[model samples]
Target: MTEPLIELKGVSKSFGSHKVLDNVDLTIYRGEALGIIGPSGTGKSTILRIMAGLLAPDEGEIYVQGVRRDGLIEDGGDPVGIGMVFQQAALFDSLTVEENVGFLLYQNSKLPRSRIRELVKEKLEMVGLPGITNLYPAELSGGMRKRVSFARAIMSNPDNPSETPEVLLYDEPTAGLDPIASTVIEDLIRYLQSAQGVCGTYAVVTHQDSTIRRTSDRLVFLYEGKVQWQGTVSEIDSTEHPLIRQFISGNVHGPIQVAG
Candidate 1:
């Protein structure tokens, strides 16, 4: 296997008295689609936030490209860039699509306005959302908003190409979309991985079955704060691991306890 792009060693997290993650170790390799899945409240999103450096783990270390990070992403830089597409698409309600996607460059980079606009156009087109630069978030449907967020995630500063995200973290990207919309997002996810060089490795946190099966090459099943199972997409069907079977079959009687 390729060297890991991100590694969480002995990671643990908690909210007040409730433990979300417990001494969990996980790795994301270069150029792989990893799916993180489990029952609601099993800490799937918590792990993604830790890996993306958005949240600090209370009891473990995070290494980016094998270099230990001292603090949150705001505190310092990682060896490689990591970007996240939030579950809600997280766009600015007041900004136009172009402004939302190009916000970083506009605020931080020295590039000319024309150049920034050009780059924004490129990214928008890359995500199959062309000519909507003037539209506001309210003008788009749920799926379109998600795609715009994707464009924003992959958006990078040209002066510092190294800052471009090599690993993308997606949190419930297809959550509320219809089946057709979900498939579109799934296809776009795979397309971004295979064709686009910016985001070669990605980890998606999703509950939608099709999103899990179609977007992920390898699967990590989390339950009770630990990785209960790990296997490939194909193995999901043949493996008889109780947790895997229960999850794939949507069975309420297996080892996994259904939440009320």
Candidate 2:
């Protein structure tokens, strides 16, 4: 088998005294879409943060392609070449859509202003948000803001021309929109995954069944700070695991306890 594009081995993290991730081991292959689904507060988003270098695991190592990344950001390890679309569409309210999309380009790359604007336009159009570049995040609908954030995340290539990023991390890509808007975002997710080709190796953190079914080539179930089940999309519907079954059926009983 080919070496995994990204690998996490025995990774664990905690906040205060509560363990959020426990000895988690996962590998994302090049050009594959991996979906992560679980109940709320199962550390789904934390996992994405760790992968993006926003958070460091207390144990284990993170390998991007073949290099080990740990505490190297201070010494300039290139910030992991990863893009994160935050759950809340964390766009800058003060900036126009064009500015928000080109924020990174302006900050990191030496590309001229005119060139950045061109790239911003291209990315916005790619996400089906053309002609809204002048709008601010507050001026747009929830779904459009998400798309603008999406455009920002992928604004620049993740890797060197020869070794581009093999993984794209998405956190709750369809969380707040209405059903129809959510579907539109879902389709856009699919489209960008295919169109960019850089995101072949990717992961999404979500609980929406339709998002899981439509976006995941493989699914990993996170529970109680660990992965309880892992399988393809088809397996999700037939799996007999109690947690998986309860989650899919939206039941309040079984092994999953809801805190009051």
Instruction: Give the number of the best model, judged by TM-score.
Output: 1
Q: After superposition, how far is residue 208 of candidate 1 from its true place, in Å?
A: 1.2
For model 2, residues 1-260, the per-residue Cα lDDT tens digits are 55577788899999999999999998877677889999998899999988887888999898877788875334345323567889999988999999999986678777788888998898898899889989888899999999998888777733334323446789998998899999998898888878854355578999898899988898989999888999999998888999999999999998988877
How many backbone clashes are present in model 2? 3
TM-score, each model?
A: 0.98, 0.94
Give the worst 10-residue stretch by lDDT in candidate 2.
157-166
**lDDT (C-alpha) at residue 103 in model 1:** 92
lDDT of predicted model 2: 0.83
Worst ten-residue run, lDDT, model 1? 191-200
Candidate 2 Cα outliers beyond 4 Å, as residue runs: 72-75, 78-80, 157-165, 196-198
lDDT of each: 0.93, 0.83
